[model samples]
Target chain A: MKTTDNASASLAEQSNDEYSVRITGFWSGRSELIVPALVFILAGFLTYGTATMKVMGTSVPGPQFFPTIVCVLLFLMAIIHTIQILRTRRFPHEDSEGQNADFSTDLLSDLADTENEAIYVPTARPSVTGKRKAYSDWKTLGMVAGAVAAFILALPVLGWILSAAGLFWVVCRALGSKRPLFDLSVAILFSSAIQLAFNAGLGLNLPSGFLEGLI
Target chain B: MESLSLLMEGFSQALTPMNLLWVVIGAVLGTAVGVLPGLGSAMAVALLLPITFSLEPTAAFIMFAGVYFGGLFGDSTSGILLNTPGNSSAIASTFEGHRMALDGRAAKALATAAMGAFIGGLIATTVVVFFAPVLVKMATAFGPAEYFALAVFAFLAISSVVSDSVVKGLMSLGLGLVLALVGVDGPSGTARYTLGMPELFDGMSIVVITVGLLALGEVLHIASRIHRDETAVRVESKGRPRLDLSDIRRAMPAWLRGTAFGVPFGVIPAGGSEVPTFMAYGLEKKLAARNGDTDFGTTGSIRGVAAPEAAANATAGTAMGALLALGLPTSATAAIMLAAFQQYGMQPGPLLFERSGPMVWTLLASLFIGLVILLVLNMQFAVLWAKLLLIPRHYLYAGITVLSVLGVYAISSSIVDLWILLGVGLLGFMMRRYKFPLAPVLIAVILGPLAETELRRALTVSQGDLSILIDSPVTIVLYGLLAITLVITGIQHLRHSKTARSQALKFDTDKLGV
Candidate 1:
């Protein structure tokens, strides 16, 4: 529990750190402002969408009524968040060593070094005691997202067993599993076992894909 | 005397050979899943819900009781063994339980946790058996306005008091409300946010969101950190785990006190076991200090392990009572259980007891049976369960990922649900990454529609006059509690900031003096 807490705590602190560094073509520490900005945009969109919702002639509130209330509240929160980000950026910390700036530059250097590898190499990083590093492995996260996307696209075509196996294999490899052959075998075996249990034993209809005739 | 006779009838029904087998299977499976980090009783019940479609309602609920008890019992096992709590409920247990494990008292720690859970659950269940009718009577008295106030109180308590950042917590709550508004309006019968997709007409499925957020999101979050080797503290129990006389004497009062703190939390919609466990841990720590036992946060205090584990299971048991009596689910697991009842065309309330009297009593009886089964299984197999951590992290995570996808796909058999699952999984991952507490989101999703419906009902009764909301004494009291909680949290926040400033100043002055 402490480990998970620290894991999240460090991510929060890392974003705080990111809020103090300069990204190219943006204001100082502006990279971390993206999520809040996106939230603001979403709030605007929701508010507009709620406005366009058709109201029924009913005694009580319309369907658009509750959504409009929530959208306004969301908009208020997003504005507050935006203001907070702006305030933090306006008042830069007056540290002598520029530690956060140095760390961000070092992070960028590492990112540049790993441009070809497609995975973040964490070996050369300094071990900061008492604080876990943020989840900075964006490439791995992207691969995971890609795996799920592929799974969704392939489920209808390749069937539950094959698509699920493909998902397992992709996720395992993306998470740095070294044994491809072993992972492949386990993935196939695991998915197949689920297929047999759910489809054969439980009599649930799992899509057979091209194996409809073969199986 | 009438209740006792009904309980006996329930026992007779639950003690059947097939039901007993189901109980054992549910207990073992629940424990196995609960020992895995990030999965709790809620997810275990959610995954098992589809299978129960084939079974009799009584037998199915009996199995659910086993799963619920076993999950609470096994959750603390991982917290003690690896310092990785199976769920938020076990967070407090990991504080001193892991230290106890590291100090070569792994067996003693396990014994303390299991015993505490047994005593707490047993007592809480008894409390339920005696007090459920009274609770049902109280629940019957609650009007829609009062229910709305209670929902507001729950939302405020969870969003403002439970989270590290009130803004983030409220943001999560808002997001859940937005998601909840996806379907057609219940009262007005108007389509608001379905966006022309017929699939969205029923709103988002709780199972998909939960599995996506808790299970898959956790997998993704951990995957991003997979480069680092997890430094798990593996301490095996050397022999049969047993609580000595002194251990038992020391833990008994703490367990009772913890149960006292946990029971009321169950009645209220205070989210889940996390809050009570922490409160129990804090209370026990202070009591230990008062008792001149200073070996806390260091040498591993038995009171620490006892209090939190007891409080967690106590909350679990009483939450069931609240669910059964009030038809109100205070936690995510209880919410899923409510959905299970609904699947069988049963609504759990005063009417449920009158309608399905035998099933209700049997379900309550099976909770006691499940508690005993869990105690025996966990006490004897503490060391064996610790070996579950020895599975390679990669395979374990990969396998869980497979199960997660399979579970979501099997439910409703909709590819659209899978897409929603993936989207929600990413949302959950981002929330975790950004340090937004997931509980508020979950609680809001589960409670949003109820809040909306109750509010509308209250308004309809008063012909859209908003003043009717606060007309009732129950509504006023709930709103007063919400206000007081907010003020207390505000004062605490101010004090925290002041202390932080003073500490920073003192550090600077000391450095200059040096």
Candidate 2:
């Protein structure tokens, strides 16, 4: 449904101006490098950390030995993984499979469970691409993350029942619950039920927070 | 004879009302976890670890046994009903199980799976009762060098064999080893990589690592794909899940064969039940083809569901044997179980059989009891369990998220654990997104310190001579096996990828021909 002329015009501009292109809505083709980079930096930190550790005795293998081996392995493995990502041409811009570049083609899902099947036959594009939506629901993800953060911060003060109820309600809303009023009630009922079960059956003390006297 | 008598005593202890109640609770909880997508028994055990502080060690372990086996049984329920295998072990069964459901024989497929699991678990546990003592004897002869080599073998086997890409697997393992280094070193009094935080000095808790990686990580992964992925349709199961005469006859033989295939892999630490289940499925498919049984890849065959289901539970049962005898965890669930044992201040090794004879036997006995209970639950209530999938997606995940946080917080009442849980949860989500295997990271976290401690001890004993690592016959044989296994598995991996590549080529070429 995209015009090739417009896509090509943007493509030309993209080549001239150095900018990041998303491989998929969920993941960028270039973002695969992050794990290797993180691993490399961790190895660097560990190497420095190992260097500072004083060997308590004249022991042959000190506390640093295992850590040194671990960091080295991390470094080597990171290098290998980076090389792998570099070798795989994620953007087969002119590949034989599909001459037309479909912006909405989710490469990850396409490759998944079809290792033994050819890359999408050019004939199959309309069916696959038509049904799919641009994924990576970052809004829902943000809501979930925010709810967890709020719950953790407020747990001690608001008490387990109230905070947990709040968390459940927000997460339900984030996950696509339309009825907030109904969701909150269900959340509170379940959360308080959990509190009573633990308090009565297990005798494990959860923080009562401000509800200490009331509960 | 001795173990049999000991097992009888175990039955007596396990048969008590209180212990039986705990077993029921564990089984029910474990089955619910196993049936739920994106959750595993390892996470259930991790969540349960905190409340165990108030539990008797015997009751706790009996419950852990129930949870472990219950997970294997319940994993396949989702596979048959929804084509979404709850665990990796259930993947192979989904090939035929879901097809059978689609063919309007859902009850038969479910029955076949339950029977397969029952027979496999029974035979495997029987083997474990007799065989674990011999394993413990062999374990007694193992010195520090042997244990270190075993851990290395575990690390190598898990990393290389389980994942599609070896590099990512090792990267996951490296992440775990780095975390393992956070606490005070055992050989030397040096605190390492702790970043000078007092909380980090105790290192990462196994419970936190497991829950974050397996549970919360899954929630985030689901979040990212919530809009894109459509909900899977439930194959409405009709009729009572009881096999007719013909169905039973076909499944009985396949179950035995699958158990045979599974028994050996259960002892090896090459990840979890996935491999054996896959292999068993492949074998059954080949055999069915040879026999001119045209049911596969279409309406599905009952034997197809039976074989993989058997292999999965058999692998799980014998994994418990390995955990008890050698203190070696052959799977992620077993690894968490080892952590559970440590929580009770009990180390499961050669000495555990002698010292905690009653506890070990009771756990083993309860497994048999739990297996019977599971057989009933899965067969009769097959449709009932399938109804769990209908609990609306938002509510299921939201509840899991809260439970993950609540479980971790309840353990220590520490805000620091919650913070670590959050960070690890993010890492877990990323790892899942990138397709790095989660089990190796878990296996490495639990086994890293043990491996390191043994390595140091061996070197100290040998006065820093590297030759001592391969000096003993056991150590030499273990390394030899490791070398041979790596070479063979490497060849197999190359062959598999080549086939995959060529098959893709053929599919494209055939489309052109048409």
In model 2, the Cα lDDT at residue B116 comes to: 93
DockQ of each: 0.19, 0.28
How far is A190's C-alpha from truth in model 2 (Å)? Answer: 2.1
Give a tens-digit lDDT track for model 2, residues B1-514. 9999999999999999999898888888878888887677998999889867698899988888888988888888888888777776787787789889999999999899989999999989999999999999999999999999989988888877555566777888889888777887766677777788888777878888888888788888788767655566678999999988988888888898889888998999967677777778778878887999989868999988998899988998899899999999988889999999987888888989989988899999999999998898888887888888788889998898888888888787888898888888888877766667777788899999999999999998888889989999988888999899778767766766576557545533332233
Candidate 2's displacement at residue A59, Å, is: 2.8
Q: Highest TM-score, which number? A: 2
Candidate 1 Cα errors over 4 Å, as ranges: A1-32, A89-134, B498-514
Each prediction's Cα lDDT score?
Answer: 0.75, 0.79
Which residue pairs come into collision in candidate 1? Answer: A21-A29
